[model samples]
Target: MTAEQRPPVRGYAKPVVVPERLDSLTGPTTGIVVLPRHLKWSGNSRYDLDQPGRIADLYRTVLNEAATSDDLSRYLDRATLLDLWSSMWLPVALRGKWEDRFPELRHRRYDPAA
Candidate 1:
């Protein structure tokens, strides 16, 4: 599946504040309780949920940086970043020649078409 079609990574729980003691063997005194793996919130960023192709482009760009061992910040020229992000999402805007063709995918809900 294309990166756009692939499911985003999401396997973590919401943090919950609580009181306990870890050193005392009781656990946190008042911090948070992370839930088990099966029950958790999707870890996707708001941007990713709202814009998958942008997120995909970010992932691709980061991978490129790691491949070259280059500092990502150095390459963050305003135009370059915007170009990559904008190009990556161009497909979403051009999908199906309009909205009616893919009614099911138009709503939010993290769909790539959205």
Candidate 2:
């Protein structure tokens, strides 16, 4: 099949941001992420509904919790970032396998970090 006819392919990676600004942020920051237009169902629950993945949510939660705890050191580690990703994606993968088969999705790459 031609590229246009194929299903969409999307990707998302955690942003590498400095620890300074993650604190002192007042609200949910606007950011980009990849997600399928259709959500997959696993058992009785559903995966993300065309929204940010759990990884992004976890990143935000970590920032919020860290700010309160005054523990900026934790967010600096890439392994911690990856752990957040793993925690987020495992459910998606399982849902995809059983329900949607991990259909290719849409993606856009933002370079704010650059």
Candidate 3:
């Protein structure tokens, strides 16, 4: 095909879709969550929230693989997210995307005397 006739290549990266409000996060408070194949096709996908650090692990997984708004709304909660935000280990892309959408999520140190 000629250069002019060639179709432009589109990016495969999906854009992050954050809800309008943090309150929109209404996921389970406490329970065992089994991720679907789409979100977690490999490794163990069951997360027992009752266990130590399991909730954070679950949140990390969901935030990384969630393909739709419903995924986020169904697996993450505002209170839980906020509690783990500072300590949660997240990918740079996910962190940037989420922080960009919600500036309040960016953790900053409180300067006592600057």
Candidate with the greatest lDDT versus the true structure: 3
Off by over 4 Å in 2: 1-52, 67-109, 112-114
Best-performing candidate as measured by TM-score: 3
What TM-score would each prediction reach against the true structure?
A: 0.21, 0.20, 0.78
lDDT of 1 by residue, 1-114 (tens): 233554543331322211121121121212223322232233432233134354344433332322221223322233333334333432332322212332332342244564
User: In candidate 3, where is summed lDDT lowest over 10 consecutive residues?
Assistant: 1-10
- Residues 1-114, candidate 2: write the lDDT tens digits: 333454544442322223343233332223333322221112322223236564455354443333232333432234434334333433322223212311221111123565
RMSD of 2: 16.2
Clashes of each: 7, 0, 0
Q: What TM-score does structure 2 among the candidates reach? A: 0.20
Ranking by lDDT: 3, 2, 1
Q: Cα RMSD to native, each candidate? A: 18.8, 16.2, 8.6
Residue 80, model 1, lDDT: 37
lDDT of 2 at 86: 31
